[model samples]
Target: MKKLIFFLLLLLAGFNLMAQQDGGTYRAQLPEITMDSTSSLHIISPEPIRYVDISSHAVAGDLPEENVLRLKWVPDSTGNLSSGADNLGVVTVIGQTFIAQYQLLSAAATPGSKLAASYDILPQHIRPLHLPVEISTPQLRSHALSLLARRNPSAIRTAKQYGISAELNHVYTLGDLILLDITYHNSTNLGYDIDELRFKIEDKKITKATNVQSVEIRPIWQLYPIGSFKRSYRNIYVLKKATFPASKILSVELSEKQISGRTIILKIKYRDILEADNF
Candidate 1:
């Protein structure tokens, strides 16, 4: 009977050891960062951070820009910082287009490595598994402007009203985003004070007067600021990936401020989106 009990205990011990080894495989392999009780470490990210996961033993928070995280080690009951992997904690920082994991240890507890005040999360350190997030807003605008600079071989779509012309020069697709190169020309001498640039999916033919339904879609990013422009104005706008049937059309509406008398609307068909070029 005693032998049977000892065998059962040995089997449970082996199972626990195997579980610990399996779990350790998924831990961060990078060398642990040292944090001392005297100063904090500033970790900068490439883009705006969306989430941060840190250990309870350390206190961490984002700055005003939300792209930098300041982390500091907490002192234990003995008035000393924690040391080693078991005593310290792990930090996982997630941004729009990047992710990094760090193991933090106390400088006072570990004497080998030097104390660094700040760390930059570079592109090479980004985790490969989580690459589906969207790029920064500035990058999207820059890409759109680059497309605008090039000449377009595709047919141009335009809408003209009150000596103001709105043209759709090109459409490009990236992942789940749609980039559009649009231009406006003011033939009249007066400057056009822009009020609002609206995008909507509406019916091609508004037959019923009582039930006119349209879905307003805002751009995820705009290349230019919304204000007055003289002569000619060229810019880019980005919207989320969407689909509409033949019965509906994507409308780009530009209206003048205050008076609201001068307005131009450009219609984009579903086929145009389907035949968009990949950037």
Candidate 2:
């Protein structure tokens, strides 16, 4: 009888140990959020939620601190806490326990005029993953601009000495579809083929206006002495019709290639149209 009793006690202890090892607990603490406000509710979990099994749902009963897992207010039909037309509330959980805080936008002076909020607790199992890499033009453009702006004049002179010349110019908009004349001079020894040139306009008030090409001209060079090789190249870029704001940034990039050392020049002119404001 003594042996049997001792065996039964040992079995009970083993069962209790197994039960404790198989179960886990959690608690959640949430902050408050108001309507029309950029606020975030913080959720704190006692134990890392990542350890929980993905197939199982973590409920309030599974939490170690069940008393703290109460909703701050009765939720409305849309699962939101509202005093009238405003939504101000949040729910957060730490481990297996959760706490919800509702923001009081208006006075709940009248009886039964309190905000109601409700939500279903969801089981979350997050997995770590890597994202694929992709190129972004805007990021590249910003980096390139920063690099160009910080370049020293010595670098520009070296490029000029290598028969490469770069120029920065702008087009000012006058009244009605009229543009002022623009000019670019290349003091390099090598001629470059204009690969591509782009223009960005900075204006906020201007409306849609068609880009018109007016004139493009290049100067010719008669073969003379080694020091007297004056050559010029020019063209007018006709832009598509487009509307623009009063404040904007116009960017133009030109590319070129040449065999013989020569300087290149460019001239551009255009017209912009605006709608007649009839107040």
Candidate 3:
């Protein structure tokens, strides 16, 4: 009976030890960061900070910019916030695309006139939660403008409808994106009110009564914001780089607001996409 009681006690102790070890591994091992109560620490992120989890030992506030975070530590009267990891505070900064974690360590104040340290959260540091890669909107717009300046031969894929001419001027490849330069020439006096500008992949030939099967492609970005234009107008559109069968065709359809409801479609072939110039 005495031996059985001792064995039961030992089993309980083993379970308790395992539980503590599991708890320690629950939180990720974060990067260690050092700061002192005598100074301020600033952290900046490339994207806006959507959520922040901070410890109670420190006071944190956001600056005017949504991407910046300010942190300051407050110590006890003895000028010490224990050296143990349990007493230490942590900071977790989350963005739309990535997450960052830092373990704050209390350090002796450096000899200076109230020092301030800044840290930037770069793309290479964080784990991308949802996005595969970081994309810059401004860079895309700038590159699109540069492509528009290039000289290309007269367009072979074009269509005319009611005095309006739609032309697919050039196709360029940038990274995983396809940039297209489209120009609309209005010879008539009437300005064109654009109702819709759409892209799609459709069958090259349609039967008399068969249902038309088409897949619409949405542009990731476009250069212009105008609703109406006169004379000659040119714009750049961006789409994800893709491929289609030779029997399929890429179509750019432009429609005007109803009343006159003028419409034009510019068809591009798979061979044209294969010949896209690199930007």
| C-alpha RMSD values across all candidates | 7.5, 22.8, 11.0
Candidate 2 local Cα displacement, residue 192, angstroms = 1.4
What's each prediction's TM-score?
0.62, 0.21, 0.56
Clashing pairs in 1: none
lDDT by residue (169-198, candidate 3, tens digit) is 988888888889999999999989989999
- Across 100-136, the per-residue lDDT of candidate 2 in tens digits comes to 2323232223233232232233333321223221212
For residues 17-134, write the lDDT of model 1, one tens digit per residue: 9987883424557546667677768988877777898866555555656688887655442264445434457788887766688776655554434667889987766774455657
Error of model 3, residue 96, in angstroms: 8.2
Instruction: For candidate 2, give the lDDT.
Output: 0.32
Weakest lDDT window of 10 consecutive positions for candidate 2: 217-226
Candidate 3 lDDT score at position 196:
91
Model 3: clashing residue pairs?
none
Between prediction 1 and prediction 2, which has the larger TM-score? 1
CA error at residue 270 for candidate 3, angstroms: 1.3
In model 1, the runs with Cα more than 4 Å from the true position are: 1-43, 56-60, 63-91, 102-119, 131-146, 153-155, 187-195, 207-210, 222-228, 256-262
